[model samples]
Target: MNKLSKLALSIGSVPAWAFTTGIVLAAESVKVNPPKYSVVSVGALLSGLVSAAIIIAAILAFVYLVWGGLNWLTSGGDKTKTEEAQKRITSAIIGLAIVAASWALIQLIANVFGLNFQEGITIPEIQTNK
Candidate 1:
């Protein structure tokens, strides 16, 4: 082989050798672990998720109402801008109402089903010999 060909082959092999060494080091350092969480049952997980959603919805509605009020104040007496701001405020109110209704519905369903939120939902576990 010519000198140029040998030089090119050496340069190409350097990257391959570096990548193989890096992969070996990475593989040796990697460790497997199960994720830790307080919520064990599916019901508990869902309850937490629902509660978070309700809080976020309420916060977003309040922010929307504030934004609409600001827009109205800065509208400079333009009729169209005022109308749009009014619509935005109205939509924010509707969103709040929907969130409240959903909460009530969830409470009603939970009551009827006797699902207690205080005590996390219990699910039966099946045992098998390892």
Candidate 2:
């Protein structure tokens, strides 16, 4: 196989190898006394993941904007390069707007359902019979 094909194959296998390793390690480190899983905990985990993804996307959009600005500054009167930089900036701005809108939508939906996104999930105490 060619060098490029070999490189592609290696890259494709990396995630599989990492996943297998993680599974093996996790199995070996199994806890004797695991914490009880609850719907509230799952909801909290999902909420945290969604929040993190939105924050990461926003950060990436800002980085893209900065990169586009740098490109524009270094274009030096080249029309094509300037246009490309402008497009990049426009795309970044649109992405940021979409992220903001998604966040707002999530908040609106949560409010409509009477769920407090900031308060996190609340687990109810279970009383045991004596």
Question: What C-alpha lDDT, on a 0 to 100 scale, does residue 56 get in candidate 1?
Answer: 99
TM-score of each: 0.65, 0.63
Off by over 4 Å in 2: 1-40, 121-130
- What is the clash count for each candidate, in the order shown? 0, 0
Q: Who wins the TM-score comparison? A: 1
Question: What value does the lDDT take at residue 70 in candidate 1?
Answer: 97
Query: What C-alpha lDDT do the candidate models reach, one value each?
Result: 0.86, 0.86
Query: What is the lDDT for 125 in model 1?
Result: 83
lDDT of 2 by residue, 8-125 (tens): 9999999998767333433456557545643347667777778889999999999999999999999999999999999999999999999999999999988888877665645456
